[model samples]
Target: MLFDKKGLDNQTLLNLYSNMLKPRLIEEKMLILLRQGKVSKWFSGIGQEAISVGVTMALKNDEYILPMHRNLGVFTTRDIPLNRLFGQWQGKASGFTKGRDRSFHFGTQDYHIVGMISHLGPQLGVADGIALANILNNKNEVTAVFTGEGGTSEGDFHEALNVASVWQLPVIFCIENNGYGLSTPTSEQYHCKDLADRGKGYGMEAFVLDGNDIIEVYTKVKKLAESIRKRPRPILIEFKTFRMRGHEEASGTKYVPEKLMAEWELKDPLISFKNYLLKEKVLTPEKDQALTIKIKEEIDVALEQANAEQPIIPDRSVELSDVYKTFEYQHIESNSKAEEIRFIDAISQGLKQSMQQHKNLVIMGQDIAEYGGVFKITEGFVKEFGKERVRNTPICESAIVEAAMGLSIAGIKSVVEMQFADFVSSGFNPIVNYLAKSHYRWNQNADVVVRMPCGGGVAAGPFHSQTNEAWFTKTPGLKVVYPAFPYDAKGLLATAINDPNPVLYFEHKALYRSIRQEVPIDYFTIPFGKASLIKEGKDVTIITYGSGVHWALETLANNEDIKADLIDLRTLQPLDTESIYNSVKKTGRAIIVQEDSLFGGIASDISALIMEDCFEFLDAPVKRVASMETPIPFINQLEQQYLAKGRFEEELKNLIAY
Candidate 1:
């Protein structure tokens, strides 16, 4: 078949050819380097170059594209410096991630490209978030996200597609059916005849196209992008293609049949496109040879420049620098009159104030818009701040968290609320793998806060009542804020919202209406790593957080002769170890209390810290009071036995008597 070249000019056709050719040539060179032990790995995009080039060239420069590992053409089409890209592959300091990551694992804001994490499907939700931002800003920009057919089976894929369709977001899902996902064939991946057919189930428009035909891909995608921009709705396009090479250089194609490889080889995108250009007299044979030589020379120069750059060295200071954005601790003093408010109301007021202060802030959760959430914390928020800001998301935790991450990438801060703290398990991947590692991986600040209604005392059983603060505190690049009192809850939440990093804000479900304090009406922020001293004494030091703080205060009140200094650790990640040590040293005895199970909770870590640092100053062995290592029971009597409250007072007395 000869080329039509109807809507495209000769120059435009030739430019598309050039874009397709660049990545194919670069990939060949990279494979050579991989075999020669110069490059670590290569995910070849030899036959699928058309999809990358076609999709990238179809979109505008400002429209964001979330691409996979094989989309090298996305970088070249955006005119990303070849030297810096090569530097990235070689793990040099001049790389986009400054040698923190390799290959296409890092995103560059300059190119409007959101890099794919290894878990391919989460980026789909990210695309929805970007499109949502575009809609909120009243812009017609669309977001295009790419994934392989194997990725379509992931939960995130279904969740993102459903959410995008429900919200009427302007997004184009480009699923490259590249025949295989790593070693698994499409036959083993899904039951659908075509990946695009899944779009119909999600209530979106669908298309199937020949990915090997560059002209067909380019023309169709350009038209689809324009249509989506005007209509502002999601569209799914499955590009039926094949990966001519192994998943990577190390994984050979022994699993693929020779006949299948031969069939795909004849339909090679670069070769077929070049033949069409020659047949139409759009490109001469002599000109094609010159263009190939030019691209090879360009790759050689880029390799030379990248080779001259110094590789990253392992320095402690340099390695620890970009884990999280540097935050300054400031204690704001307010002279406003105090009003008594419950813990839940304090958090509500703080969130309301933050929304008023930061216009770009968005809050999303289940039943949050009209129903005002399950707890009534966000009651009347939709009426005040519109549906765009106070969104009610589907019961898809993974998609909403990844969407919040996307919002952060688009310079918008987002707050994600888990209906209960135990439900965080569904959204743990994006929080720990993507959101927590975004800054360290690519200097992308994930300005998002995940609010968790945690803890036990209301007999809500295992699923609803569990103190899971340790889940995020152990994960680096995340801040964990757990407060007990109304004043601290309001102050710490405001600080978490303002921090330019991912934060896990744990609110005790039992303390929502149980605890009240005279809190200032105005907004204020408490320092993250500072501990609050409830009372001072010289006999013993009690360390606690969340619900344990109240138990400690009650014990001190009942036994005035115990003479204890009570310390409340407001934030668990930037734990106020200074205050803890000072209090422990002065009192000469320490007791760490927590509501979580006793085996591997935060109390164990605190007890160890006190043992190591306050060893000489201790007058008695450090004691830890925590719940029994059992699942939270449904019965009130069994639940009370499972909690630390049952034994905390006795434990404190035993420690004092020692």
Candidate 2:
């Protein structure tokens, strides 16, 4: 598989040389681009060009890559349109991300690239997921994730490796041995002498390659990547290379002594490869120039095309788009099921029925498989649904969500259970990035339902008892729902799962076993973007959601004189403004109630909406009932102070008296 001048035909060898040169020249030209306004920034990847280009070329065409910012060479070598590449740096619409993403988010899916740019090490988990998809699809496509030594220090790097090893997924984790991470050198990023030394801990076959040598980098990677894919296992490849530019355009290696920068520059990957090609008679200056000029011309032309193409303008109209796919709203027969169902069982029955209707549905989380999750919601389901449908994943939040997103993109309806709502942060990235924007970014839909036990009531300490739904209400492309009782939980869940968009179906942990009501054995569901009137009165509109609906409604029953209109926001993303406005118009007063802290909570959003839309109708200024602006306390006495205890009553009396 080695592309040696003596070993390969002239045509093949010449192509390799050309591929190696483009990245080098692009990096060289980028200096001028920075001076002009064309490319506002650059990650030179100068000395590492040969390794990125050569190794990438060695792999099959359809293989997937999650490369770091420094691996600019790899994209060019992989043949992403050059003009689009330049336009990306130019911050134009035709940029790979349609200009919605940052300059670094340039990988195109058509080129077998699943793009990412969170922190440095997060791509490892994603790479593993992409590779897992390929394995399941029985596609011989390998996934390669590249990062710097700084990224290797990240915990996700190890988590991804371990998961890949355990699942035996086909991913090549490549560590480009860039001597430093921004200002700090390799000394600060990790203690490992060589990164390969750390791979065995994850049960991966590790190998180190001389990244400065193009032939060596290519041959070794090709060997490992092919072997890993054929058998479909994971491997760790350490490419000993260097970062030739600042981390991004903003960073300057002022700390690195000029002597050190100059010393590293001597091992420039492109120059060294060129010398090898000439010495071996693989290429001459004339042929190299012809290739370079041809590529440059093609790139210039691509620039015209990409510039001519329009940027995908980000919009708010589609703000409610993709939260669910099935447009045909199904009726929720909640009234018929008023006999024997508990909140938790309703959730289970809803999932069971919906999954039965849809064959692509899958559910996974810690203890979700055999234990039916900690709440017993998924109980007896393991026997009925096979392992593929009900899976028990390791306790890694990133992995759990990442894997679910992977399954979802492959056309499976993935439902990820976050053991508790507090733990939902584990899978936040996949929820926000992959699922939320997949439809918008790639025009590909990822139908996913992320179900978590939310809210606090049972004395499960601060971590175990938390209503974190407010934490993610503002997240675009995500529909946040909190079902108070069994009826809505099942119906709303059905609506959430069937919808094209990704949903965060928050169920109260307390409601699981607390209250029981009768539910009939019929298929039914409730629509999103619509609100439910749990109780109706003429004094004040107490807008609440999730478990808060129960508390607010209960508070209303205490004093018959306080006729509060309870608007239950079954779906949070759409905000059900019409419901809120109608109630405010009729009652002439609005008071938002939620259990999350007052600041940055759903209450804030509702209050803002009320002031903007129903301001003219207000009897008084809007009022809100929420937790104190502090973390939930560990002590019960302290916790009471932090909880949303009696604001509903106080607000009710004040508004009536007003």
Candidate 3:
């Protein structure tokens, strides 16, 4: 009777068999639809359904799961409606993402299951973030993230695993070692035999198991899930399985060996489970057949229902609606200001005020707890908010970014601090792909702020000093804020914390201590996409932000004859185009300044916008003043020469003369 069924009850065995059968049948129908040109593409997990179904069934419904594309069985086993599943594939209006995406790239707050994007490794870090949040809230829950053997080779895999291990977060990493990454054999993917060995290196309990054996997978995963809930710890389990089909129907199995295909066919999870059910007398032939017929009828009806609905129209208007989760906040009177404070103190006060105002707000960064960060931005925050809310994280930048995404998914507003802006290169995947695009993809608010200490006036050198805001300014679905004044810094951070989209808040290192101004201690809100007009004149317009704004002011003071209109574009993405256009229209001359490099800079974009919107009002060609296209030199004099002050002053004088 198939080795006594591993002490699983007959009902449990029947449930497992049924769960394995549903996804296999659904994917089979999808393959038929693909051939008929009714569907685009399908990633088939036909043979390896047991692993997804087993692990999913083991966890409690409340525990979060981040499932990859192949884990269709996870959705089916969780009783996700077949109509919605088919609707997504058919690109119907009722689909989870409303036809914005076709594959595993949607999520629902109600379901607590994060749908995945094309990039695989970031989800693991996101799951770790969710688990860490659960721990902070003292919620007894474990998070499970799924990936393939190939994903283990990614840097994020190691980054997430190390953070989870060090923090002892409640997480289970399930690696399905199906022996091929799109056509490359597992032998070529890694030198080691088992992916679980990497888990051991990360200080986690690791194991390898028979993935086709549903009973063992369910029992072991259930035990581990229950244990981790009580005392949080991460574990890794590698399932040794094989994909019976090609990567997809289009990418045929030409690279697969005939002998290997034949071998895996003999161990087909669905057929083996059905045979076991029949041999053990778990169900009669008629009953088993009836169950199959029932599931098939259900799938067929779901397809019909999904097909009956209208296909989602590609509407640009609909795309614009959910770009940012804009909210209305209380506006204080004009004279509601409190006291004068430095830029660094304003940041500390803003964070403290945000945390006090919103209980769901938390701060996470490296050495931010007792050590108070390298710049002491978060100093004394630990004593006030406790260590649970203000957390000290490892040097895993990608994990930090992704975990904040997870926290936002769990209905928490997280503020992530990069010790230096240059280090953002390490976490660029999640920053650009996951955090920036989540809202536009699925109508979900990423609801996170990444605080970057940027600029190179202090000669922090190439590694620590960088002005990378230009990169994010060009990206859609992200709000890039670089505040110049202490008042703007405090007010904008408060607003960014409350924003329902991902905002990259760039705090210039040069202005952190050099600039101090009168700022309100009380919470205040600054509307996004609105630039502040620092000075108004008719001769020329100088548009800049962050540290560049100060340089623009200096140029104005030095050359009063120029009579320039100064505009500080506090938000770059939701750019204050109206202010820029109006100023350029009035002055009939414009100069864009930036701390980033000369070529391909934010000033270039601003210059283009001015040309398009105010061409009739122009007096001369739009000019741009930016740093030279090279890394910031260590010497202060060279760095000054590379900056935009002297060049911007010359441009302004020339514009006035013209």
Candidate 4:
């Protein structure tokens, strides 16, 4: 009522009160519809409806919104069609999600609502991304992300806030602290009494408010939205509310004691505000009754319409709709074609070709723009491609990745450079939660590539030199490509661009200048989930990839009589299982090799798969040759002792003797 942005009239406040009431009715009506079997799932704002609605009211219509499961009030106020909303709940064809997606994957660009995934967290990354996109496009729009107090516990929440604050992104992180995270209270989640306090840890502004009060929410959100528009920066606003209903429609108040429920019911947000309005004479009984009745009627009509609608008949073709934004394929003539270009040179050419091929391609990260990246792996690029295409960024790893995720959604292929492999933890949120799962959430893949300079022998210390493949090798919906030579680097990077999943193309910082092999003359992309044959022999199988492939090749050459078949598993996630199986069965003996720690790395994953599928064919125990279980040290002497490759001379001799 105090704000003039919408010029508060008694009637206007009454209308907002009406809008707030409608969400409650909608939530109730939808629950009834769910029991009637019209919808599959339902999560109501209930006591917290005012916050969702009021926060949205403070925001610009053009600004993007990323919401959680209980954001019906936000969507309703944003003017998202009720039928489409019901369709999403019912998994109907009329929904933007094509009916096959999850119950919470709601999106409508028409309403400026991005995707509202029901999972407890992950929207923070989305909010950061949308805001970054607006910044890049010169569009001054704030992207608001809605979450609960419990979501603050997720690593994504911390990482997103850290990066958004660093970049000064126009993102408003709104946390609805409704006292309980599925019966585990806030006290169980964190020591700080308020969730907003965590925002200060990331060096961002924080606000705490009484969520039940709509007027307060409107005032706070309006001021924050204005401040972010003028000078962009991330801020966390914690709304202290209570979850009046059960976690879901199924659970009764079995977990919540009767006395507490009754005690909280007396302070019911709806009844409390209605009384306040009546006392102030702003809401006459006649007006209040009419407004309540009017909202109930509208919801009744929507429910009736929703019930009358036919169930969605899914077209199988719609299943693959928007699986990938773009795809390309090419073939090279022969092995000689690959023998013509140097490894780093091939990568440079592939990056350039991919950039020239697609107008939406953009490369970023530390030193990638002007210096052509830290290792000069991206050399000659800034000059040939221009600064916009190849960009330099601050040492903020999280910012580089967060920016990439935003661009990927905006139809830009964001190619990021991680100066070192071990330092990627700074950007892990965008990797695991955002890029990897973005497709699964919205039915769309992020076509971004994170070029990580990995592995050791350069004696660059623990922070700068190391192979951390296990960090993401097993994460779903992500392509992990480790290229050993120039041809594979060029071909795989090109293929990774065409793949639907996000890719972490691990480039050896040591091999950036050392490894020299001729790349093909023409543009060509290799197929993923396929292994490359480095050498053909049948006595033993050395299954490896990236830097370890060279070691395996050398070991085979040193002992020619071993007749080992060296297979390079170029792609880790969609792993070339058939190739490994065939080699293991043919040789009747196998050894897994990797540059990373033996524990929990690729060797373990490969060994498990072989045991599951090829145990019957094995003649002996499958061996694993990996670096010792120690950190890649700073000193070369200590590092060398720990850096045992798959094809080390002593390991090869020991295996042969066995």
Candidate 5:
């Protein structure tokens, strides 16, 4: 009977059967609803129920599991209320994501389940972070992350596996080889015979199992999870399964062979397990019928309740409320004890102070452990805080950033350093989609500060120097901070670290050593959404941030008659519009200077804002002085010509003359 449920007790066997049965029944009901046009979409895990059920039942409740779109059995097996599950599917306000996201895309911390994004690969790195948190906390918990065979081809898959292996993190990489990624066959995806073979390259123990066999899946996962808890290392298990249904309700399975579908239908996990249970006398006909009726009634009630609850209405306040967790504005009194330091050293001091304050703070990047990073900003951090907090990650920006998301999920604050701001393009998906959207989607606070060494003037070429702050500033739920001087750098960094939302802290590489000031040695935070009035005058208002502040200062210093009120916008997202409006109104003209290209830069947005709100007060047209629309040149002369430095003085004179 089911290959001898030898060590399993009668109750445990019955529980497994019920768990598997419930999802199967639920999927059937969902498919009916989809056809009836009640639900928007459905991703059916019909033939592959055993893997989700077995693996979930095997793990402890406290242990985290990052489930993909099709793992409906995971929610059901965890005994998450059917009402909430149905509500989520129905897109009701009662759902976990409050109708912000649909399907299994929402995660509930109460269930210790981190939900999957549409991009499946990032969650693997997120699971690594969760496992790393467990390790740091000395908890015996092992995290289990699931993905399809199609997802194995992703770079995130390789990066996550290697990182988990190197750290020996307790993670179960459950790969469901479902024979197809969307409509593409497995043959076209990868040439490897089995996905598990790829795990061997990462030096991880690999196993292949019949995913339809409930008993086998359950027994193996239970043993593996137990072993991982004791040894605390990663193991890859490839479950050979088939998707009996289409990828989603709309995408029909026309690409799959009819013969293969028929074969898998016969080997259905629920049918085989039911027959085995009946044969062992663990589940009689009467008991099975009663259980089916019970689950059906439960679903019926949940669906009704979900329907009765209000659907999401178009309310601006409600829509904007959950985008970011409110961080109380902190007022730090000026300290008497001050030490003169460079911008880089000020940032170092801020990080060290933050590390001492937050025990769970983690810093991760390449060469950050001992090399102190390329800029040496984190130099001696490993020695002071040890390697646990100061982590050196492989060149997997996507994975590390996703890991920071996971670490945030586990109540750990993290700071991810991008070697260069331009390199953020590699890790853009997780940062923009997952980390930035987590709070708005499911009320999850991503306490992460991504330290971006940005801007030009370093002669580091196109790939190294960039002012990409506008990318994040436009995205909802992300806080962007760009400081000018050493004092502002230290203070604003402290604020960013303390912020509950994901903050993109842009550190201009040019200002790192060139700028120096007396910064407070003690911990302090400058409030965000508040612009620092660098220099005040009545002729014109110069709105700028990062290196632009220095450019404006240099231009104003060279020309004493310009008499412009220079506003340093320390934070970009929660932009200090009030200050900009007030200064522009007072000056009757404005000029926005930026190191980035002229088109679609922050200056463009500021110019529009001035026109929209302060149009009547303008004596002349609002001007923008910015670099040329070209890749940052490696040659010093070409770079200088491309920068806004030469144009700022002329633009200021023209605006003042008008």
Candidate 6:
């Protein structure tokens, strides 16, 4: 053999060859299924089998793996049962995602593998979170993550590498340089001679591997994996290979050059390994034929079983059941002697209490360490809980969120603070795609809370001030909580921390210091989907939340004769529709006030809700008073005019008169 195999026995080498052959044969059958119109799509990693098998051979069962769509051999090598795998591909109930997804979009915790989403590069950062969790748990288990050469161009690639290096995390980033990304060649994707060369810039050890040689790939990755567990530093391996097939069955190989395709076909990893095994006399021709027959029979049975199994019947109840953990109302007792505190202090106390209550809770954000935060919401937290728990990440929003998803998957509750709510646009993909859809798609619990300090009126222009809760409210799997008063902010944040799904907690920046109220000293949680009736009246109902609640209250105080009922919607998603309908039914008129822009905002939806549910009871058209559709201005006068507050009195009067 060209590569060292001093410790590997003959049986081990035979098993490695078997593992490499399995995925190649399985995917080949899958391609046939695709052609036969039984399967939707097929993405084959035919030539890259050696790297996937070799890497899997080095991995311990307890170690974590975040695999890309192309690494089927990794699953085979890890002893993932063929029946269940085929079940996943066929969208059966026995599949990992229970027909929610197909083709590598699912994973099971039992296997310690995270099945990747369609979007690439984000999983690499998530792997670092797994590594970080392992370190915290003192398991010293290495996490191996895969991506393509094309994925290196993604910003998440660099962010993941930087965090892994800075924290000395035990993660192996394997890049399969398969020569093409869908149709775009590597030449167009990058100028770097080797993708591993980029890893050096991140202050990590990197090396190249001949991806077709199973012996070399296994030996090198095994050594690297062992060293990583001991020292806990990131390592990058660039596996040079070729894509024997097109990106997927739908994409023909027309774009691939005939010469290049022929050359790679000649160097097919399976064929090369078969020749090596024959040359080494590991098996006679008759025995090889017997092994091949056995594998073919196994594949035939798996295929037959998968075809016979009933597909998961699509049900709306399954889709809605896992969005949030259903819990009976606990009815937390109120503290009559509670101390008065500002909104920011209430938030800090909530975080402190949550961290104290749950040892697994981790808080992360920029400038949240010794600097507390830009808003000081996390001030003195590092000192109280230690830096490991209260981490200050780099200015990478996507990685911050992606890491939270990883940590959550690793059985840790993560609370991420977005320095400015407007900055959430940068990390919107993970929040909307991964965290928000995890439970609904695969029943994966993403216990993450993203603290967004939102809204305007402090003269902070567009970039720093934004009410982005509306954007997330439209998403299905996420819970949106926007608190107006200190009592709700503290209680709802605690609830968000305890919830098993992703919650976007929007704290109004304008109310951080403006409002002060007595909050329960003990750790308490407010029930989700419940609105608070701040003031009771019979004439008109003002439905508002966050800073808009304060504005509505002020407007009502000035116009006491209006006899308005002010309802603060503490949670945007899982909105208290019953409370809204009840209030509007009594008052016969309703006004929805919001700090978000008027166009397609939450206020518009609430207004529509009232019109639909309470139309018969209403005396006038459902009114929506929100900020102008235009961006907030830099000038103080124009900024005030741009806000919902500027039109509050006028809109309130119009609604009352109507």
Against the unseen true structure, what C-alpha lDDT does each candidate score? 0.92, 0.75, 0.87, 0.76, 0.92, 0.88
Q: Give a tens-digit lDDT track for model 1, residues 1-658.
A: 3455757999988999999999999988888898799999888888999899999999999999999998999989999989999999999988888887889998999999999999998899999898999988899898999999989999999999999999999999999999998999999999889999999999999999988888888899999899888899999999999999899878989999999999999999888889988988999999999999999999999999999987688888866878998877666766899899999999999999889979999999999898999999999999999999999999999999999998998989999999999999999999999899999999998999999999999989999999988888888899999999999999999899999899999999999999999999998888898899988999999999999999988888888888888999999988999999999999999999999998888888999999999899998999999998898998999998899998999988888889
Candidate 3's C-alpha runs over 4 A off are 1-4, 332-337
Off by over 4 Å in 1: 1-3, 329-331
Q: Mind giving the per-residue lDDT tens digits that candidate 6 earns over 339-422?
A: 999999999999999999899999999999999999887888888899999999998889889989989888999999999999
Candidate 3, residues 1-658, lDDT tens digits: the string is 1434768888898899899989988988898899999999888898899899999999988888899888998888888899998988877777787787886778766667888878899999999889988987889999999999999889889999998998899999999989899999998899987889998789899989889888888999999999998889999999999988888788999999899899988888888878877777887799888988999999999998999998666778777876666566555433565898899888888888889988888888899999999999999889988988898998989998999998888788899999998888998999889987888777777888999999988977887778999878777778898999888888888888887889999999999999999987677778778999999999988899998889888877877776778999998878999999999999999988888888988888889888887999999999888888899877889888877766877777877777
Tell me, what's the RMSD of every candidate?
1.1, 3.2, 1.5, 5.3, 1.1, 1.4
Which 10 consecutive positions of candidate 6 have the poorest summed lDDT? 327-336
Q: Which 10 residues in a row give candidate 4 its minimum summed lDDT?
A: 1-10
Residue pairs in candidate 6 whose N, alpha carbon or C atoms collide under 3 angstroms: none
On lDDT, the stronger of 3 and 5 is: 5
Instruction: Give the Å shift of residue 588 in candidate 1.
Output: 1.9
Candidate 4 global CA lDDT score: 0.76
TM-score against native, each model: 0.99, 0.91, 0.97, 0.78, 0.99, 0.98
Q: How well is each residue in 1-658 modelled by candidate 2, as lDDT tens digits?
A: 1234335566655666677778777767677767776656666677777667766887887777777776766787777777777667665665665555555664566776655565665667767666766765678877888888877777677778888888888888888887888888888877877999887898889988878777677667777777876798888989887776777666877777899888777777677667777777778888777888887787667767865766566676653453334357666564453557788888989998887888767787888887888888888888987776787788888776766665554456678888888887766766677667766554555667888787666666778777877666776667788877777777888888888677888888777887787666676888788898988888889898877777776776788778878888888876799988999999998888888888888888789888998888988988888887776776777777677865667776786788
Looking at candidate 3, what is the lDDT of residue 594?
Answer: 89
Residues 313-338, candidate 5, lDDT per residue (tens digit)? Answer: 88899889889988987777566699
TM-score: model 5 vs. ground truth: 0.99
Collision count for each candidate, in order = 0, 15, 0, 6, 0, 0
Pairs clashing in candidate 5? none
The weakest ten consecutive residues by lDDT in model 3 span 326-335
Candidate 3 TM-score over all chains jointly? 0.97
Runs off by more than 4 Å, candidate 4: 1-6, 9-15, 29-44, 60-62, 81-111, 114-122, 147-166, 175-342, 367-373, 378-403, 460-465, 520-524, 581-589, 604-622, 630-638, 644-658
Summed over model 5, clashes come to 0
Of the two candidates 1 and 3, the one with more favorable lDDT, higher being better, is 1
Task: Write candidate 4's Cα lDDT for 126-244 as tens digits.
Answer: 67767777776777778888888888887667767876887788898999988778778777888987788888788999999878777788878988899889888888899888788
